[model samples]
Target: MAATGLTPSKAGPSRPSAPREAAPAPPGGAFARALRRNLTAHAFLIGAVLCFAVFSWYPMVREFFLAFQTTENGEVSWVGLDNLATVFNDPAFWQAWRNTLLFTVLALLLGFAVPFLVAIVINEFHHAQGYLRLLVYLPVMLPPVASVLLFQYLYDPGYGLLNELLRLLHLPEQQWLQDPDLSMLSIVVASTWMNMGGATLIYLAALQGIPGELYEAAELDGAGLLRKIWHVTIPQTRLVLSLMLLMQVIATMQVFVEPFLLTGGAGPEGSTTTVVYLIYQYAFNFNDYGAAAALGLLLLVLLAGFSAAYVRLSRAQDE
Candidate 1:
C-alpha cells in the first residue's frame, strides 16, 4: 500500500478536567449568610430598642434617682426618704388615695361593665355592624381634650343637657360637678364616656373570636341569654376580661386629664383629688420634683406588685 501523508492518530488516556473551586464560599460561612438575610429586621429592632431606651427606660431611671434626691438653689442633694415622709404626712395624701380608690370603683362599675355590655349588644345585631363599630370608636378618634370639654358642656348645671333632661322628667336639677357628693361620680361618668370606645372594640373583637358552637351547645341546654353569657361567653373570654380589668385598674389609678379638665384637679372641697393629681401638684404646682418622684415611685411599686400578683393568680387559675 502506498504510504499516506498523515499517520493514523493514536488516542492517549483521557485527562479529567480540573475540579472547580466552590467560589470560596463568599466569607464568614453561615453567620455571614444569616446576617445578610436578616439585616433589615435587625435594623428595625435596633431602632425600636434605641427609642425605648431614650424615652421610656431613661425616664424611669431618672425618676428612680429623682425619688431620693432634692434640688435647692440649683444644688442637688440626696435626701434619703425625706420626700416620702413629706408625702406621707401631707393630709391630702390619704384623701387622694381614698378618692382614687373611689374613682377606680366607680370606673369599674361603669367603664368596665358598660363596654362589655355594649360589645355584647353590638355583636348580637345582624346588620350595621360596621356602622356600630365606627360609632363606638368615634369618641376614641376625637382629641381627648375635645371629648372632655364636650362632656363638660353636657354636665353644666344651668344649661347642660343632663339638667335639661332632668327638668323634662320633672326632676330637680342637682349640681353635678359643684357638689362634693356627686363630683367623683360625675368625673367617672365622663371618663367612662371618653375612654370606653377602645375597650369596647377590644371586647367586640374577643367576642367575635369565640366559637359559635359553644353558644349553640348552650342553647341546646336551654340556656337563656344571660346563662349563655355566664357559661359560655365569660369563660371563653376570661383571659381578655382579666387582662382588661388589670389594665383598667392601672389606667384609672393614674387618671389625671378628665378630673383636671372637668373639676380643676381638686374639685369641690377636694372631693375629686386623685393620687396622680397630687403628684402633679407636687411636681408642677408646688415645684417639689422630689416629692412627686417619691409619690410616683410608690405608685410604681404598688402597680408592680399588683401586676405580679395578678399574673401569679392568672397562672394558678390556668393550671
Candidate 2:
C-alpha cells in the first residue's frame, strides 16, 4: 500500500463530503410511523377497521347520498334540496322536534336529578354498598321490551295499577297513555326507571374516584352536606355530570322504543311523534327514504353541535 500524505485507498471514489446535517422527515412520515406502530402493536385494529368501514362509514355515506336523491323504479335521481325543503315545510317536523325536546327536558329534570341524588347517597352509605349498586343497576339489565310492556299495563287508561292507586288515595284517575298531555309524560316516567339506573351507577362509580379528603376538608370548614356537595361534590363530579348530560342529549334525541311500543308509534293525537319517530314514519310508513334521510342528517347535525359545545366547555374547564 503506497501511503503518502494519507492518500486513501480507492475502493470507490472517495465518498463525497457529507452534508453538514440530515434532512428532517416529512410531516406525513411521522404519521406513517405511528400507523405502523399501532398496527404492529395490536391485532384488534384490523377487526375494528372492518367493522367501522362496514357499519359506520358506509351507512353514513349512503345516508348522506340518499338524502339528495330519491329512488324511482330502481333508479336514483337527484332532488337537490327538495327533500330538506319538504321536511322543513312539513308540519310534522316541528311537532316532532317539539316532542323530542320536551321529552329530553323532562327526562333531564327527573332522570338526571333522581339518579345523581341516589348515587351520591348510596355511595356514602357504608352498609351493603355492593348490594345497593347491584339493585340500582338491575333495571338497566332488564330487557327493554319487557320494561316497555310492563309499563303498558301501568299506563293503561282504565283498570291499571296507577289508576287504582289514585282511586285508593281519592285522586281522580287521569288518562296516562291515551291523553296527549300525559302520554309523553307517562313514557318519560317509564323510561326514567330504565335510564336512571345506568346513569346512577355511572355516578356511583365516578363518586368512588373522588377523594374523600375533599369532603373531609369541607366538613372541617363548617360546610353542611349540601354546601359540601355544592363546593366539593359537584365540582369533583362535574365531568361525569357533563358526560351524562351529553349522553342524554344524544340518546333522548333518538327517542324511539318507548314511544313506539307504548304510544303505538305516535302518541295520542300525534303528541309524541319525535324526530326519530318521524323518520321511522317517513321511511317505513310512507316509504319516503329521501325525507327520512334528510331529517336524520339534520338531527345528526344538531346533536353534533351540542356535543361539540359540551366538549369545548369541558376542555376549557380542564385547562
Tens-digit per-residue lDDT, 1-319, candidate 2: 6555544553558768867887776567877778867876556878889999999999999999999999989999999999999999999889999999999999988888999999989988988998998888898899999988788888776878899899999999989988998999999999999878889988998999999899889888999989988998899899899889899879988999999989887778999899999999899999999999999999989988989988998899799
> Best candidate per lDDT, number?
1
For each candidate in turn, the TM-score is 0.92, 0.86
In candidate 2, position 158 carries an lDDT of: 81
Q: How does candidate 2 score on lDDT?
A: 0.89
RMSD of each: 5.2, 9.0
Residue pairs in clash, model 2: none
The 10 consecutive residues of candidate 1 with the worst lDDT sum are 4-13
